[model samples]
Each structure stands twice: as C-alpha cells, then as structure tokens.
Target: MDVLIVGAGPTGLTLGIDLARRGVEALVVERAGELFPGSRGKGIQPRTQEVFDDLGVLDAVLAASGPYPHRMIWKEGERLGEEPLFEAAAPDEGAPYTEPRMIPQWRTQEILYARLVELGGRVAFGRGVTGLTQDADGVCVEFADGTTVRARYVVAADGGRSVVRRALGVGMTGEAVDPAPFVVADVRVRGLDRNHWHAFPQDDGSALALCPLAGTDEFQLAARLPQGAAPDLSLDGVRKLVAAYSHLGAEDVTQMRWASDFRPRAALADRFRAGRVFLAGDAAHVHSPAGGQGLNTSVQDAYNLGWKLGAVLRDGARQTLLGTYEEERRANAGAMLELSTGVHRGAVRRGGATVQLGLGYRESSLSVETRTAPDGLRAGDRAPDGTVAGVRLFDAFRGPHWTLLGAATAPAAGIRALPSAPGSYGPGVFLVRPDGYVGWAGETADGLGAYLARVGL
Candidate 1:
C-alpha cells in the first residue's frame, strides 16, 4: 500500500477520504472491531466545516448535526439563566460557517468513513498495529495478530494512547490542564428541555453539564469530579452522579449508552514525522475538550498532510515536500494546545480564535509571498469563499488541484484562474493550495510559474 493509516478515528478516516479522492492507494486499519461509539469531541469548528465541504461530506454532516444551543444554568431546581455557550458571529462571504456545529465524534467518523468507501477506499477493523519499523524507502507495520503490512508511508492516528507513537519512541510533553477528573457519557434522560445545555454549578468548585446532543435522542452528560475522585462508568453510577449534581432524581437518567472519563490535559508530540512514519490526530497532540479544539485540530492535521502525501506518492512531486507538513502543523498544533488549555482554565472564551478560520502557514517554506505590498489575503492565508465570475471560489478549489484566483486572464499554464473577486480578495493573484491556503500571491503571474514548478503544480 502507498499509505497505512493506523487508526479509524476522525483523523485516519479523513486522511483516507482525502487520499482516496486523490487516487492514492491507502488503507485505514482499526484496532477495534467497529467504529468508536462515543460522543467525545462533539464540536465541529467552522474551519473543519470547510474541510468537510472540500471532502464532499458537508451535507451529510449537516444533516447529522445541529447548531450549539444556549447553555441553561440551573440551581436547586430553578432555572437561573440561559447563556450562549459560544460567542456568536455572523457569517460573511469570507467565512461561511461562523458558529460551531454540534455532532458527536462517532457520527463524524461514520460520515468520513462512508465518504472514503464511496471513493473506493477500504478500512480493515480488528487489525491493531503493534509496532512499526521504517527504512529509507518505506515502513513495515506489524499487527498484534502476527500479521504484517508494508507501506510507502505510515501515519499514527491511533489516538492519545497511540501504540504506534509508543513504538516510534516519540515523547509527548504535556501537563494536566485540570487536576479534577471529568466523566462524559451519552444517556437518555428526562426532566430537561432539549433546547438548552443544562449546567449545574456546585459550591465545591465542581460542576455538571448535560448538553442535548444535536441530531440524536441522547444528551451528553459531563461532570467534574473532586480531586482524587474516581469516575463512575456504570449506568447506576451515572444516575447517582446526575442526582448528586443536579435537581433531577437518579431515576431521571433512563439509560447510559456510553461512558468514559479523563482528566483534562494538553500535550503535543515532540515531532510529527519520524522518517517514513508520521503521527497525526490525537497521536500527535492531545488537548482539553475545552473550546472543542482536539478533534478539529486532529482533522485539520490530516487535511494538511493528506495533499502533501498525495503530491509526493501519487503526483511524483519531490519527497522533500513532505517535510513542510511537520514544520507547518507542529506550530499550529502548539498554538491550539495553548488555546485549549486557556479555555479549560476559563481564561479564554469560545469565540473567533476558537473558530480556527484565521489559522494559516504564513511562515512556512512553501508560502511564497512574491508581492511585497500585498494587502488583504497573502501567502499562507486561508483562501476565502466568494463568488468570482459567477463561480464560487471554494468550488474552484474543491478538487486536488491548485487554484489561481483574482487573475484577469488565465496563465498559459494549466492552473485554474478565477475572475478577480475584488470585494473579498482585493486585487492580486492568489495561488490557493489544494488544502485551501494560499501558497503564493503576487500582483500577477509574474512569479507564479516558479512557485507552481516548486510545488509540482
């Protein structure tokens, strides 16, 4: 195989979809016998929505999700007040999705898996990667069942406790964002309105939140335990905890679908790439669920690495192009780690920064900013969506090809050129990368040819 993704979570499945669409030979291997059945990492950021748009899964995702509801604060069976959990922002031409959408991580994974299969990709479950060894040319992965698979490259998307990352001896440096334990579960409940996320704050500095998960009949119950307290994962335990934290009785919780617990933490892998082996998603970075950055950042990591891998393995681009993936994504992941930590500590609110639309690769080696006086959008900035010459900019950038926007006339080269949408992008040639960032920008195509040649366009 060209690529072997070692987990079937959002990261691996998304990478599989991207590779499949690019006609790259890739396989996704899952240790579990089935897809994850939890509602962890439930918030989908606006930037990730754009990614789904490109991968052709946005409609399904939208159908399976709903907008984040206002948080309803309660105390002693009395409704205190309703507050917006996230700061609201209006959608503009530049950014289409201005608010976070609520969809369980499992549903998102299913959507990506379906899209991958639609693109002729395959995922093998019950095949856990025990270890991996890489040479100058490729990687050999050994499974727990004594089976082996070889691939030109391997990605470790096996999550925070990733066995692949352990085999690679990559160290993750991090600290606990919260010392208190947290328990989250999907449960069928009563005595709560489905329109708001119900939160009950305790005087002991602990809290409980029961959020109505959109597009499903279940509500996600989250509770912060006291220091040194063990999380109860049983259905009876969930019921008791609900009674202890809120006004509802233990009988109010009808059923518990799934449950897991963890202390909030923020960690990043020392390196994303180790020779032919690469780490993506939770394997590379683990974040506090605050601000909903973990899964969004993970999915974007797959997006950033996917096209570059496709360029090298499928399009015959130089192998050196792959190095930029680590250089670009590591820094972004670090920033997101800090942001998530802040949100966990209640130092930052969920708003524009949490949206992730402002993220880009301005300082990367691949970002070629030819124009010294560029104004609005520059190299390493995300290409915005807008109508240009009766064609949407995102529509032009949907496929696995580079796009040249704001050009009055098409360059002699085979690059896609869209009429200048001066209102949104200003007047300049914006070379949008396949991953939706501007790789090069200039007054015209004066230096576009060199940039294209460098990226194998």
Candidate 2:
C-alpha cells in the first residue's frame, strides 16, 4: 500500500477516496465492522462541500441530505436570535457555495465508502493498528491481529486516544475547560410536533437544548445532566430526559431510537506529522462537539493532508511541504479549538456565538494583502462564492468545484478559453485540491503562473 490509514471514519475514508482517485493505492483499516451507525455530525459547511465536489461526491451528499438554512439561539425557553447559518445573507446561485446540508454522520461515511470502492479501494474492517515503526524508507504497521503491512506513509484518522499518535510518542495539550455531561438522543420521538429548538438554562445545574433535525420530524434533544443525575440511557431514562427538558410530558415521550452520554473536552496534538506517520481528524485535535465542527474539521483535515501526501508519493516534493501540513492544519485546529472553547464558555457563562459560520483561515501564505481588521486580513480568505459569471454550463447542483476567482472586470487572457463545462470538481478555471484550501488562487490569468510556480505546478 502506498498509504495505510487507521480508523475508517469520515476522515480516513475521504483520504482513501482522494488517494484512490489519484491512482494512489491507499489502504484503510478500522476496528469497527462497518460504518458507525450514529447521529454524529449533522452539519456540513459549504467549504467542506467544495472538498466533496473535488472528490466527485457532492451530489450524493445533497441527495442524501437536505439544505440546512436557519440556525437559532435560545436561552431558557427564550429564542434569543436566528440567522442564516452559511452566508450572512441569502445565497445566490452564483455564490461560491451556499449553506451546508444536514446529514447523519453515518450516511456521510457511506457515501465516501461507496466512492472509495468505486475507485478500486475497500476498507479493511475489524482491523486495528496495534503498533507502528517508521524508518527512512517506509512505515511498518502492526495490526491487533499480529499482522503487519508496510506502506510509504501511515495516517491515523483514528479518534482521540489514537493508537498511532501514542505509538509516535506525540503529546496532546489542552483540557476540558468546561467539564459537563450531556446526553445526545437520536431516536424517533412520536408526535412531538416541535419545529424549533428549546434551550433551558439551569443556573443551579447544567443547561438543556432541543435542536430540531432538518428534513426529519425527530428532534435532537441535548441537555446538561446534574453531576449524578445523568441517566443510564435505558429506554425509560431517555424518555425521562426528553420529558423533563421538553414541553412534551413524560406521557407524550414514548419511543427512543438511540442515546449516548458524552463529556465536552478540547485538546490538540503537539505535532500533526512525524516522519512517515501522520495524525489527522480527531487523532490530531479533539474539542467539544458544541459547534458541530468535530467531524467537519476532521474531514477538512484529511482534505488538507490528502493531496500533499499524494504529491509527495508521486513527485517526491520537498519534505518542507509535508512539514507545512502541520503548520497549516494545526493553525486551523488551533482556531477550531478557540471556536469550540468560545461555544463552551457561552454555554457555561452565557452569551456568545454558538454557531460556527465561515470560520476563515488566518496567517496562511495564500491570503491576499488587505487592510487589517479586528480579525486579520480575512481578505484572500476562503474565496467568497458567487454565481459563475458568463457561463451557461455552471451548475450549482454539482458543487464542490474549484472556482477560478478573479476580478471579472480585471483584464486577463483566455479566461473564456478555459474549460467551459462542469467536471467532477465542477466547472472552474481549474480544480484546487479536495480541501477548501486553494492550491492555486489567481486574481488574474498571470496570477495562476505565480501560484503554480510556488507549488511547483
């Protein structure tokens, strides 16, 4: 195998699909027999969708999920505010990408898995990485079953408490700034008839939130549990939690689909890549699930690392580019850490933005020069989206496309001569990597020359 990925979650499978599509033989191993069946990450950011577009899997995601438009805030049964979760304003078809869709985590994994299989790759289930040792040539990964496979690179997409991270002697820093127990129940609640979220602040104890799942009548009921009041998660216990936090009485709460107890925590690995072994997804960073960024961040991490790894395998680029993986993504991880902490503090102290909207990159080489603001030059930030100008072939439905963005008014040659049709990565001047991070961000036709030179394109 060119690359061996530990943990077949969204991140690992996505990396597999990207590598397989690039004709890189990548192997994915998971401890679980199949994709996780849970109501994990429910929101997908627009930038993430662009990555899917690059992988040629965005349409399946849109079909599997539905657009999630509104995100609302509440405190103790009072609706504090509601706003468009993606763009601050309405999204036009010309926009780079619109609001993200909401889909269960399992379904998202299923799509990636299918794509991976289509690319002549398959996940090795019930296989866990027990030990790994890397030398200059490659890495030898030992499975729990006492089997070993050697690959040029090994990636740990395994969740926090990653076996590869531990084997590599990497340390994670940060703690659960605000420790609280919360119950997440993903079940069919009968006849609840509630369309909006209900938040109840408990000054005496933990808070509670009822977020309505889009495209489904079932509601995701989340509530802070008293130190010892956390339920055992039996059907009756799930019913009790729903009854207490929700207006629906105990009599009204009858059925439960699934439920689990989770604690909020945040941490980051001291290093993201070491030698031929690398860490990504929750393996590299872990944070509270409050902002709905856990899986999205992980998937994005894979997107950032996948192309770089493939580049190294094919062209053997400078090791510095591989080192930059940690520099770039760890910086994003640090931002997500702060975002997660902000949400936690808001939950604990009250009053802060709980929803993560367009959290752009900072201090990257790609950012364009612009006047500094309270936040750094968000200019040259994630390229803002708009309708494809002067093209009838632009298809908004087949998104996750690389948009060749420049001043439409700026004089550049052959902009019209570029591919004027939709592609797997969508119709754009050219496709960037699967990750939203731009490999080529050109403000003019000649600007592409500068970007290509930098990346040795």
Best by lDDT: 1
Kindly list the per-residue Cα lDDT of model 1 for residues 352-449, writing each as its tens digit: 99999999999999999888788888889888898877787888889888777767666544467776754767777787888999888888778887
Residue 162 CA displacement from its true place in model 2, Å: 1.1
Worst 10 residues of 1 by lDDT: 406-415
lDDT of each: 0.91, 0.67
Candidate 2 — which residues are off by over 4 angstroms?
67-88, 92-96, 200-203, 215-217, 228-230, 249-254, 347-362, 365-380, 385-454
lDDT of 2 by residue, 104-151 (tens): 777788889999998899899999778888899999999888999999
- How close is every model to the real structure, measured as TM-score? 0.98, 0.80
Scored by lDDT, model 1 comes in at 0.91
Q: In model 2, what are the clashing residue pairs, if there are any?
A: 50-400, 94-386, 94-387, 95-385, 95-386, 95-387, 96-385, 96-386, 187-257
Clashes of 2: 9
